[model samples]
Target: MHPETHLALHHTRATDLRAEAAAHRLAAQARRPYAIRTRLGWTLVEVGLRLASPRPAFAH
Candidate 1:
């Protein structure tokens, strides 16, 4: 491989690694209070809506 191409690939991989790390850290920090709560709230709303409305029958 050409030196420049190799260097470019290396830089791209490094950037991707950093981005993945940042995403993981943010997810971990938010998992407890942010993501979990938001997901649970949505789930509750969905269940409530399902309970309030009957599902439509599908034609075979």
Candidate 2:
């Protein structure tokens, strides 16, 4: 009886783990990174800022 109960608990836990993993996979696919798009805008802004800012000290 105790062994059967333990197996039942283990089965429930495995199902819970599978559900959690499925949820994570769904979330990952639904909200993916737009690296090229994001990076393009950011890189342009950064370049503009650097061009507009003063240069650091340097010896001749």
Candidate 3:
């Protein structure tokens, strides 16, 4: 293949890959709130469980 043609093809492929990556990033961003909410809910549940458990006695 000619050098110019190869460079053009490479550029096109790079652009396409960048666009695909951008799309994936956007999709993850869209789900960011849900992910955060899920993590917060789990953390609260953990805290609640800890609070409900009995404490150990300390030795004098």
Best by lDDT: 3
lDDT tens readout by residue for model 2, 1-60: 699999999999999999999999998777666666788989999999999999999999
Q: Which candidate tops TM-score?
A: 3
For candidate 1, lDDT tens digit of each residue in 1-60? 999999999999999999999999988987777777899999999999999998899999
Q: How are the candidates ranked when ordered by TM-score, highest leading?
A: 3, 2, 1
Task: Show model 2 residue runs off by greater than 4 Å.
Answer: 33-37, 56-60
- Model 3, residue 53: distance off in Å is 3.7
TM-score of each: 0.51, 0.57, 0.75
TM-score of 3: 0.75
In angstroms, give how far residue 32 of model 2 lies from its true place: 1.1
Runs with alpha carbons beyond 4 Å of true place in candidate 1: 32-60
Report the poorest 10 consecutive residues by lDDT, candidate 1.
Answer: 28-37
Task: Please give the lDDT score at residue 3 for candidate 1.
Answer: 100
- Model 2, residue 3: distance off in Å is 2.4
- After TM-score superposition, what is the CA distance of residue 42 in candidate 2 from its true location, in Å? 3.3
Model 2 gets an lDDT of: 0.92
lDDT of each structure?
A: 0.94, 0.92, 0.98
